[model samples]
Target: MKSLLLAVCLILALHCGEAAVTCETVAEDLYPCISYVAQGGSVPDTCCTGIRTLNSQAQTTEDRQSICRCIKSAMGGAPLDSINNALSLPAKCGVNLPFNPSPSTNCDSIN
Candidate 1:
């Protein structure tokens, strides 16, 4: 859970660009998705809801990159097992996430 929070924060922080979105908001918006990524099952409604909210919040290149960084930071890097699940999450959740969740993804280039 902590890792997830960190990842969300870092990702949002990196993607936030000049907006300065907080790690706390990112953490709140992304916490639900972590379980799906870890366990590989149907994504919970809460998770999707959170993701949708995140999508709405991350409306800029910097915000998207910040989110990506937060996610990677949470993982301490992309955990091999959860990476695929993380990557597919946006499409499955019905949101067009602007950045990839992989640790290697360059948040600055997200736009």
Candidate 2:
């Protein structure tokens, strides 16, 4: 019984440790990039920095999907230009993403 309990605790700890960032956290960091992406203005250093931080922090597939969901949710109320610009943001920020953040993208298949 004690071994089973220990195993369960270890599994939970591993799962918890794998998630380096949450959707809320990603939202907070990436929200600043919305204006730059919506407009055609220069991507500010702050925005790029946030993008880089997001890329580095989201290490697992779950993290990536969470970010995707947050981005999709946030973009749902945005203009077309903003959505289009979001697709271009990874390249613009020099961050390579496994899947393009688009309306049609299946975040589950990101890995």
| Per-residue lDDT of candidate 1, residues 1-111 (tens digit) | 566645556665554334555556777777788788877889989988988987888877777776666666666555677878877888998888766777677767778
Which TM-score value belongs to model 1? 0.75
Deviation in angstroms for 74 in model 1? 1.8
TM-score of each: 0.75, 0.75
Residues 23-42, candidate 2, lDDT per residue (tens digit)?
Answer: 55765566567567657678
To one decimal, what is the Cα RMSD in angstroms of model 1 from the true structure? Answer: 3.5
Compare the candidates by lDDT and give the number of the best one.
Answer: 1
